[model samples]
Target: MTYTRSEFPDTFLFGLSASDPGDEALTEGFDSFRFPVHWQQVLPRGRGEPDSGGLDHYKHLIDTVLRRGLRPCAILDSSTLPDAIADLGGWRNRDSANWFAHFAETVIEHIGDRLFSAGPAARSWTVGKSDHLGTDLRAHARSLHHHLLATGHAIRAMRSYGMTNLGVEFQLDEPEANTALHAYFHGEYTKDYLAKFSPNLPKNWQRDFDSIDEPIDWCALNYAHFKDLDGSLPWSSLHREDTGETPLYVVADLGSVENTENLLGDIRSDLAQGAPIKGLFAQAQEGECLGLLQTALSGGKQPAPWVAPTKALHGHWNMVADVGGTNTRLGVVTNGHLDELHKFPTGSLEDFQAALRRVRDAVGTDPQAVVAAGAGPLRDGVIQLTNASLTLSRDTLASSTGAQRTFVINDFTAAAWSVADIKAKDVAVLQGSGSPPPGTRLVVGPGTGLGVGALLYSEGHYHTVSGEGGHMGLSPRHRDEVDVFDAARRIAPECFFADSLAIEAEMFLSGTGLPILYQAVCMAGGQSDTPTLSAKDILQAAQSGADEFAVKTARMFTEHLGAITGDLAVALIPVGGVFLLGGVADKNRWLFGQEFLDAFNAGGRFDDIRGGLNLYVSEMDEFGIVGANNFCKNALAR
Candidate 1:
């Protein structure tokens, strides 16, 4: 059967084995590439400073792979150690493990962030049986123990830099006729070998092994022959039971079409039987093998949709728009700053297109790029507004504005991106002090509707994770809250009551939900004479301390907002801080006083973690516009 990319899991990586630099074309149809970075070649002495020229070459190779949109997986080869280290006993020496770890650290310091994955050595452990290492069993065992130790040490070193995707390659040879040798190589190597040789290992060896959390993220298996593939499945299951890792099969030495077909057929069968394979790596010296693999994977499908350009367009204007439920804001970014800001009411999609045309006419020239962030879920480069009848897509934006590149993202995703460029003067701290730890940042806003998104910092870039977090179910915390929620359910059963008696966080926390909350409060408090009020009137009366129900509603709103934010913060652990956005939070800053703090810090056993998190209210009026500009500058410039 012909296999397509869609047949495999989306996260399953297909890749090629690259041999040299400037082999970008070899990676055209692959998601990743495996290349060797020799230890002796990089560090001639294997102990002191590295060769500057060697480091530069590898750096360029990694950059080229990334430019081709392929993950670069480095193989730190130690099969041929430097002559200086070879004379000093090589893998037989305990100190060699530490030296290899230092070498790994040096490489990571140069390009760790860009690396998608790495392995300690490339099929080096299997070379122990060769006569070059002599015919002594004890000596071979010592070398094997040190190799595993070096692998563990290398993994530990990478973990220190927050680079965790790591693995080890093993060559699976055919089962020997001699059962003793067969059992020793296939089964004992991973199971009983470590425990049996523990007493003979170097001092403090267990420490290094314990440092590894999951042993390896993946185990790469290279079979000696096509028929040997059947042994891999059971072997993988056994290994996973022992080490908690799945296997990535490596298809090598494909000399004929028959061999390639047989290999792929076996892989497909294995996958159908639920073999728990992680991915596939096809070893290729020419384009023939990769070409066939790509053809089968494509299954006559068309190419993917147009993606936004990664590289920035220098000396060109970029247009950005914040398409909201009530208003639409458009602006042009020139020389890395937002300018020519324009605002108008949002109507139909056609109206939005007309507004884009007007903006283009006023600018006197078409922008090189356009990005619009609307309040909704973004799917296939299109956003359907949650609280508005309008829909925005990259196609419409490009057609209307005559732009070369276009993007559509969720509104809160733009807010999350804006956190990367937010200034101190534009925000007021609600909780915690000093700068937050560098990691993920959460952005929550209450406007026409509640919106939530998170920004994760990794590989020198900020990635946005947007979703309908605002729709999460909210439960009553106390007797007073129970009465209010019951009243809310009776007032708006469709909005508050679902399969359960839980209400969505946005039902009582957003602009549209504010008046609902006010009426529910009035009804629950037996205020039969209370007049109907808009969200504005309720906030005004609460601020003036004139209406008892209005004041109670405002307090309940802020307190619930604080409680929900704290719960999300605890779940996400966004060490980069939680930023509160939108006009509601900015204008009603006084409401986020003592009661808000008390509700937010009510995490019982997790009080310390919740209370220590940095919380702020953003006062920037043009946050979405600034965020779109930041997206153009940062994300596209990558």
Candidate 2:
């Protein structure tokens, strides 16, 4: 697994935002690994000893990585760990030598033997310390020197354990990289001007200026990378680009460097021109980071000083995997942020792979890091190897008239595949994140049809059973007009409730349901002559409390929606919140807000049945995207 000079043309060294060596490399097939060890974990709270947390577990994890052929680097994180926060009274201050040295000694004494390098993933001061009051600018950046020395010393000490490399990861980790607040960092020109106005400026400003002390000596960060996780953050962030008119993403452009792919080439050029080290470290979001890095590495292009991790997975700190209906899409969410997207549409085998190719090419991505593209639902029924079986399937279809044309998938199983974890916080739904019972969660979206998913919590994990539970027959509330029953009968004439007897809750409660209710109202109220409008139009009028018949329809739709949600809740009682998603949930907030809650919570004697359950709206249309990214990141992590 050793990276040869030619393997990385510029001796690129890739690693993680977090993770120790063996755990890092072995997981994602990286030659090297990096895991940040919180200093708080290394040093105890209130000036005590650090918690070992059974170093053997870590040792074993690393050993696992090493056995899998990967190099691992350990990072000593002093700032963000909870212990550090707790010790600092909810603030990351105390950049003291004793703390640094003590933590360094701890690492050297612990698993130093297995480490490829001891890293200090440097922090770019937090907003609190800079804006408020803590340390002056001089003291802020100077704080790094103490920690840097400690890091260097630890590397020296850990090397005694048969170690070979030591590295520094100087980060401008501020997602607000390009904010105007950073204008002070430019130099004395702004410094004098600012001092003249404020006299005693905020400690936060001073703290921020601390890191700007010296150009991070290139010689020290011999193997470094600039992590710009989001490009649109800069290009379209704050509308600061040359085009001042375009809407801006809150995460401004200066905070990140995603606008230019050549940004990497520039960093390499700087390193070669005696700028610094020879690697580039960029952020690939939670799941896509290492995958994209690997993609870059595996490509025919000559690699730079950027070092790739031997292993990669969605960091446990914040990871989510969302499987799509029909197994066609997957999304990865990290700490609730949807970051990566992978999708495979159910199509002709050949056409599917071709579409996948189109998707990859459109993203300007390479296919080397792709493990496999799978098909089928989680219930274990249908699976078509759309990627692998494409050519043969196409030929078969062309030659044999009996050949199946389109791939059929069990959308429920696909939904379950994404929700297969032992536990989770929020299940994707129409009403964002809802709080349910202490087990798995269930959401039933009844659109044109029903969409059923069960969130199962087991052995400290959350699993969702996405199934076609929508087609179930609806109960006739009050001898529905035989007319409606007759129409339903025409659509589905079989089974106990079909053909005039069965009414699906979906047609009565989902995105397509409201209109039916409205249509029924119009016909019953003698306004059947009114122009036909889509479900969306009815809700729009309902939202404004207009269109009398629309109001009645909205109320009825809300009632049915609540009834179905109640049924699902009673069945799952999900401890994690129930999230309502899709077109109906997003737009019909008025209905859910007013009458739906009233209906669901209005149990004559069983109010307690629905009392504890929480409801939410899934705002991001990219739930599937996040699910896809989560799947990729988690699969890679595993």
Candidate 3:
């Protein structure tokens, strides 16, 4: 079931839970019913309800989601509906079909208007019976079929009503029907229930149902079986056993991480009976769930041509570094771009040694003609490491000659190669909506460490610019920010940039900048003892306008970012505009849009310079990998 990442689609579902509670606070009741449900817990009663401008909420939510290049799929929950009191088990007063039809209309009226939408359907949700209804196979079966047929009909009806783009999906959705042996032993039902049901199922089920492993589209009955044991046990105990086995220890309630190993164990029985099942809804883990999800979702996204990519001319480089926290691999491209080839680990000297050894072991040559002294810093994070702690290779050298090929170089310089290359891969983020003549581009990365660089776009190609832009002066935008910067300066006054001889610019933009900012805000707000907040905490405080320091920090961070972007804009005249790179650019996009944009466009009379200063929030996570590859491809060829 485990396949390489290469096997998966470029865009696959990476949904994060966002379930919120609705009428009656029925989260516990739904679980009590012994069915899987989406308990999307969100602050301030999740998005879009009737009072929440129902239809408008749906449109805005979906549109905003797709705008980020992520497809949206709604996981409908019983909690979403207005609270109503009804008897347990099929208790909606009106028929279940009528209830769902109403729900479908609310969804389609807004979301279905979009041609690119795939589904607004419920995910892994049951169609019948509350916990008090008890266990009834016939009822479960009848309710499931009824919901599917009704939902399908409702969708067709919606289409008939001119909402042709509406989509409806059904899941088998039964957790009580795991192993026959469990039903026989600990199931709430007596032996008569199984004895009657088994005989009703095809006569061949008992002998071969357990072994059937063919891919079956059981949309009529999306099975959630997660255990595989050939023994008798109570349904409750069996259910616990099935959920307990996991690759990683998980704390789940009703709808939580479990197995998909034997998810559809009994679906074969129904398939053999000529049942028309269409898809599955298993919570995959390890390799099992991945296959089920991929296989079932092979249909892919619809309404093509969603994005447009411009032409990019690649180039080569002399060096590269793997600035990753783990699986670090750096390389020097003596004859090409750093990405196309591998750079030995030179973020640290020991890394340098190991990288050298890897090459020596592979090529069997310790040549000594060119020694350009390649020594990486003996440090990591803010914690300094001795040379002994670093990985060393025998023949790793930045120079062709080994003797003098070991000297200190900026890790940011190595990091810049990839950053600049990423700017080349997708320049639109910086280039803006309409095409601009290729111009110089700026790349700023704020991750575990802050990395900033600029790349020249000339003659339709990118030329990497090497400079310590991040190490420049810490230009505080607000008085509070200035105070915070001064406070941090007190802690490490000697931490100014060296050789680069730049003033500390990271007081508000780097990883080191965050803690300093967070502390200052908390202390100023008189919440200094607020549990030693993280940078994220400070930003959260600002969102609520809780602390002046936090608001100040957020403003300062954005404003400084704007100043940097503006400075780089002037330096490169990046006719192509400016690009905010690294993890920070992507995660804090809202921040960039508000503060950065406000500041970037504040260059006095030169504000017009920002007219085409294409600002973009990159969605590509593999920019480094692909950028490096692109760099390698272009450089090696050159």
Which candidate achieves the best lDDT against the true structure? 1
For candidate 1, the lDDT comes to 0.72
Which regions of candidate 1 deviate over 4 angstroms?
Answer: 1-314, 434-437, 497-499
lDDT of 1 by residue, 8-100 (tens): 666667777756847645546677777878887788888789989889889898877877767788888786777777777777877777788
lDDT of 3 by residue, 29-50 (tens): 0111011122122112222343
> For model 2, where is the 10-residue window of minimal lDDT?
246-255
Could you tell me the lDDT of residue 492 within candidate 3? 53
Going through the candidates in the order shown, the clash numbers are 0, 98, 43
Ranking of predictions according to lDDT: 1, 2, 3
List the global CA lDDT of all models.
Answer: 0.72, 0.45, 0.42
RMSD of 1: 17.6
The TM-score between candidate 2 and the true structure equals: 0.40
User: What C-alpha RMSD separates each model from the true structure?
Assistant: 17.6, 24.5, 27.0
Sequence-dependent TM-score of model 1: 0.51
Overall local distance difference test of candidate 2: 0.45
Model 3 CA deviation exceeding 4 Å by range: 1-327, 330-395, 398-431, 434-437, 458-461, 479-482, 495-503, 524-531, 540-548, 622-638
lDDT of 2 by residue, 214-290 (tens): 22212112112234453212222222332133211111112232332344444444334443233433332344444
